[model samples]
Target: MNSNWFKLLMKATRVQYGENLKLNGVPVVFNKQGAELLIGDNVTINSSFLSNLVGLYQRTIIVTRTHDSKIAIGNNVGISGATIYARTSITIGENTLIGGNSKIMDNDFHPIEVEARNTDIKEKIAARPIVIGKNCFIGCNSLILKGTILGEGCVVGAGAVVSGVFEDNCVIAGNPAKVIKRL
Candidate 1:
């Protein structure tokens, strides 16, 4: 196949693609640059099989968020149709499987009050960092908001909106997501 198409993909990897980098027929687009996007070895960031981590740019450059950001995906990760719109930093740990159409953000992007949102206040909230631990499985259509951390082995149910820190191996769901059960 054409490995030239993967040069951009290779540059997108964190740790300078480390020892081994694997992308399987994936369509990837970057909104901005001067930031590192780290994807580890044996990780399939495939857009053909499942479209995850594919940035939208309307054939030009689809940006989910307007700020330059850092997105780090660790080893053995499987992301399928996940949208991460970050103005700051987003780190996902090893062996995590992010589901289809899930939107994750590291910043609030806007203030609670309408007036504050009109100015630069939202930018303050948008600069915070987000981290997800090892072996977590986030469900389809889930929205993980800014400043939220999911501990190891967290399973977020479909269509859930999550904020704040959640316990490891717990099943969380619903709006403003809560722990439903522990796995």
Candidate 2:
């Protein structure tokens, strides 16, 4: 899709974006009423399969699920077919790279307790805020769960499941992400 048209769509959803926003393909962005989705200058989002060499599994999905939720992406960030869903809040700092097929969510989306799953879905949902600091690189297929805070210049390895507070300049990897190296 044309970048101009995409920008119009973003405007229609009340998503505030800065200059030089490049859209390789039209992304799926849904900013709920009374929610905020802010994108900074020089951002590049690749949604088409061939746009990123890493190969996207699907179009990029950016959603603010609740009225008070927010998703803020800083300047010079690159996203490739990732799913960034926020029930509360999510902030990605400047110059960060969210690799292909990655999932960054600030909510569990459903109740963990079996009884609450059907009876009290909204009230029992678990959610927290996610903060990815400046110049961080989240590798392909990574799952950044609720309450995760990554400090500046951190690098997450592909396929890692990250769900904790990681300090600055850490090289993280594995199922439950560990600090493999400090950069």
Candidate 3:
């Protein structure tokens, strides 16, 4: 779809965005009633297969699942086929690069207990806020889970499974990501 139409659709869905929003292909953005989904100015969301060099497996998906949930993407952010699902809150600071096919979530979606998984899922679900600081780079295919807090200029290596708090200017890699190098 064209830029104008997309902007209108976003507005109708209560997704607020700033000027110079660049869309290589249409992204799947859903904001629940009373939720907030904000995209800052000069942001580029690449959804099409050829939009990013990393070869995206799917289009970019941004959703706010709960009424009080929020997803705030800062200015000059570049997102490629990433899936950002917020049950609580997610904040991506300015000048961040979210690589292709990455997933950022503020909730587990389901309870850890098998019994609770099917029943009373909401009560058992664990949700937390994720804060990715400015100038951070999330590598391709990485999984950033709930409660993650990355300080400014952190670099997450490809395929890393990140959780917990990380200091600034570090290079993080591995399945359970750790600081591989301090930059």
Candidate 4:
């Protein structure tokens, strides 16, 4: 199939998308009932797998499992090969850049306790909101977990696993990421 046709088919699947939502490329967006996926204008998504092209296990997957779940992406943002799953809410502000193979999620998917884990995957799920503020840069192979509030202009280094509330204009890196520098 043609690229444009593929994009049009994908666009038909989104719950809500704003002006110029496909400025760069198409993104795979999935929303269940009571779930809302909002995308603002002039968003650039260069996720190869999302476009029905041959990619190396890469795709832009956005899923809101529950009815109350939401995934809101602001204008002028660029995302590549990212996976964003929301059980509550996941908001990415304007002018943010997300590198390839990155993940931003608002739910733990399972409990920490062995018994609870053995019981069910959603038994002890701790879902929270994830907010990535404006002008942020998230490097490749990063993980932005539940309850993470990245302030404006923050930078998350590659291969970092981040959580918690971080102030504006700083660099966060490492596993269980910490502020490495102030920018």
Candidate 5:
């Protein structure tokens, strides 16, 4: 669609996309009901990964995880082919760039403890918030787990799995994405 037509269509549909936001690709699909999705200004989405996110939604998988969550993105962010599910909250700060085929999660659907994982039912599941701060760049095929925090001006390398609180202005890489160097 043309720029003007797209704007009009989005407005008419009541999709709360912010100003100067360009959506180049399709969404991954809404997995569960009451999942709040919020985006900010001047952003771009470049790829599609519907299959990767299918398990998170009730509509796709037969034995699906409960996913009434919220995702919040700040201004001037660009993302490509990422599968994200926010059980509580996954907040991305301003001026952040997320690489292709990444995964961000704030919950562990299955119980991790011996009793919880084995048993059919558990009192509570584990979930932790993820925060990516301003001016950060995440590399391709990275996996960011619950309670993961990336500070300002941080850069994550390709094919990495990041968890826990992280400092700012550093280059991190690897399976368990570590700090390779400071930026």
Candidate 6:
């Protein structure tokens, strides 16, 4: 609940924000300047949640590594200790609540090939966009990977590793994250 860290973060990042954007604590990191980070109105970030004694170390991280990469968070979205790394685009719809330690990414960040792995080259073709629909709930420790799309009102269970598309008004769970129930 300190103002000092938030002030420092505000000075550090090139974030283009709308009204009433709140930060509970410092984000772990925000890298790449040419990339865009757009946060909508009434978005709240609480990176200190569920950190136990390591609350100060735990933080929400948003990174866009290239000029074409972007991260967009819609209105009334509340996230805690979430890491959103975008090589392409990652968009979260309005009224969504993302729990502590969740991760959403739109790219692999590296090539699988042994020769390419050691090089500094990136696989731009492998990256895709991640879209989470309105009024969704992403539980703690959930991992939403590249090309994943969740329709409106979907709920992702804690510790779920989600990939692919999920229909609206459903409950998604498990490692690969399947529709557990249709709400």
Instruction: Note the clash tally of each candidate.
Output: 7, 0, 0, 1, 1, 0
User: Please, what are the lDDT tens digits per residue for candidate 6 over residues 20-81?
Assistant: 77777656556477888888899888766554232323588888878878888999998888
lDDT of 2 by residue, 1-183 (tens): 688987998899899999999999889999999999999999999999999988899999999999999999999999999999999999999999999999999999889999998697696899999999999999999999999999999999999999999999999999999999999
Query: How do the residues 1-183 of candidate 3 rate in per-residue lDDT, one tens digit apiece?
Result: 997898899999999999999999999999999999999999999999999988999999999999999999999999999999999999999999999999999999989998998686696889999999999999999999999999999999999999999999999999899999999
Per-residue error for 116 in candidate 1, Å, reads 5.9
CA RMSD (A), model 5: 6.1
TM-score of each candidate structure, all chains considered together: 0.75, 0.98, 0.98, 0.87, 0.75, 0.88
Worst 10 residues of 5 by lDDT: 55-64
lDDT of 1 at 94: 95
Candidate 6 ranges beyond 4 A from true positions:
1-12, 29-31, 49-57
Candidate 1 lDDT tens digits, 1-183: 344556555455422444355544444446454565655776654444333434322111112244357777788877665566667778889999877667777766666666677775755464567899999998877888888899999999998999988878999999979999998
What are the clashing pairs of model 3?
Answer: none
Candidate that beats the other on TM-score, 2 or 4, i.e. the better one = 2
lDDT of 4 by residue, 1-183 (tens): 454675566557556666766533545667877688888888777766544232414767788888889999999988887899999999999999888878999998888888888988674888999999999999988999999999999999989999999999999999989999999
Q: State in Å the error of residue 168, model 6.
A: 0.9
Q: What is the C-alpha RMSD of each candidate to the true structure, in Å?
A: 4.6, 0.8, 0.8, 3.2, 6.1, 2.8
Local error of candidate 2 at residue 3 (angstroms): 2.3
Error of 4 at 7 (Å): 5.7
Candidate 5 lDDT for residue 65: 26
Least well predicted 10-residue stretch by lDDT in candidate 3: 116-125
TM-score computed on alpha carbons, candidate 1: 0.75
lDDT of each: 0.68, 0.96, 0.96, 0.83, 0.70, 0.83
Alpha-carbon deviation at 32 in model 5, angstroms: 5.1
Against the correct fold, how does model 4 do in TM-score? 0.87
Better of 2 and 5 by lDDT: 2
